[model samples]
Target: MMSETNPYMMVGERLCMDFINTVSWRESADKRREWFTSYAKWVDWCIHAEVLTGQQAKALLLEAEEKPSEAGDVLKQAIEMREVMYRIFKSISKDISPHQPDLELFNASVSHFYQTLQIIHEKDHYTLKFKQTENNLGIMLPPILQSAVDLLISNNDLERVKQCEGDPCGWLFFDTSRNRSRRWCSMSDCGNRAKARRFYQKEK
Candidate 1:
């Protein structure tokens, strides 16, 4: 069963956007909630994010059972990387330059994960892949980082990255609309709340 604490909202169209949005009600210190409380929860999120398959998750869980400390370390690393990504993208959405320290940290991770880069030969052609080590439970993180890196360098597409207009929502998304007018993360959730608030103000 999925955890009730996290609704697993996939409102962010891009994988990196969705990964950065794991937290709920981000700006309200009283209501803010973190989704990846433990290694298992992190793995579950990766599964829903399609960053890991069932078989891969199963193996990682088994390994985590044996190396709890290592698993915890991975969780910490994942959250840290996610926060760095959030800050970088949040600045982009607001038309400001991301902090230099954040960019350096992001590049550090990119350099670290790039070590696992390998070329695999397929029937028709070759493909680049991140090799998974049997003992590394954080294997699912590389692709997520790669997604952010791709977007950061996407030039014109970076303009489509936006934060929800909903107050304190703190959710980021990629606007794929032809006219790039998307504001809320989801029309059914934050969007409806905004509409209701506007209506109430009009009546009052």
Candidate 2:
């Protein structure tokens, strides 16, 4: 059963875009920094999904000091982490038999993904220690990822996981519906866009 107050589920489809685009796109230092800044927004969305409280998210962000030079690499790692989570969520949704090899692979993947994050966090100097910033900007992943993983493990329900059906928007989301029939990432965004496009084509 889905929790009534799971913040991670409320992050919406945009979270995936933010995670993937930040790393995949090539831009100047300023643009990279701007994208990194969106991390806070991602955390905020996660908080809304009930994955983490606002206080907890804020503290997590404070744990690592942001270095301008490291922004690109950090973004890359974030995208990788998001992709791993996406795959795990999708596998859980498959409803495969318990003895299936695919299920076993999915379980192993989740474990390895978590361990890899830990190893990377340990090796990165920016993530190893907390530092005070003039503008109070810092970045960290431990608390955020931990909270999300804990929620998924506790629930153990694959039905809550969903991939958006919107065209050109292959984002992952956690469906919290009673009927479990959610399709688009957000009705106001992707859903509306799709509807509008269809209408335009019909008019033509």
Candidate 3:
């Protein structure tokens, strides 16, 4: 379910899906609504940050609407955006190792993302499988899936990587604010929304 109060969070969650089936041309109106709602937030994040121009965002949205099979290509663009975020993470670190200082955490995060990719590839969306085996201490999840879960737990900031707060959004960005007060993946949308929400709440 998508919540207006936390649009960015919704986008984060949906990114794991290879194709946003809800918003694709083949989906129902309800699914389209859900997809657009989350996608709007994502586009807003990129546009506000200038990572993507208004025209680009609009075109992407149009593409999403017209070509359901192109969802994978759209996701690929998102992955490229994420790479920029990884670079930012590297820049901020003082560690000199060829591998990230937080290599274990990075591996975990990557593994989690990889597992999500596998799920997308295998199932075309999100699906969970649980199996119990005899002679086992207890139930066991697949190792790749476990690694993915562990990665998310290990890398706290993976969630904080944001999109801009602007109308037409661009790429994924990291929030390195001292107070972690960043709103937009780049501040256009996040900041504006924060201000507007505060004003509306105060009026009520």
Task: List TM-scores for all candidates, in order.
Answer: 0.95, 0.48, 0.27
Clashing pairs in 2: 6-49, 6-50, 7-49, 7-50, 7-51, 8-49, 8-50, 8-51, 10-49
User: Worst ten-residue run, lDDT, model 1?
Assistant: 1-10
Decoy 2 TM-score against native? 0.48
Consecutive 10-residue window with the lowest summed lDDT within model 2: 18-27
Off-target runs (Cα >4 Å) in candidate 2 are 1-10, 13-34, 37-76, 91-139, 154-156
Q: 96-195, model 2: which lDDT tens digit per residue? A: 4333453455456446445444322455453522232332322334444554455466565556666566655555566667788888767876689989
Runs in model 1 lying further than 4 Å from the true structure: 1-7
Which runs of model 3 end up more than 4 angstroms from their true locations? 1-40, 80-92, 98-204
lDDT of 1 at 170: 96
Better of 1 and 2 by lDDT: 1
Work out how many backbone clashes candidate 3 has: 21
**lDDT per residue (tens digit) for residues 43-106 in model 1:** 9988888898889899899999999999999999999999999999999999999999999999
Q: Give the per-residue lDDT of model 3 (tens digit) for 78-180.
A: 4343343334333332223324544554455445444433332254567544332331111111332243244335467654444444433322344557676
Q: Comparing 1 and 3 by lDDT, which wins?
A: 1
- Indicate which candidate wins on lDDT: 1
Count clashing residue pairs in model 2.
9
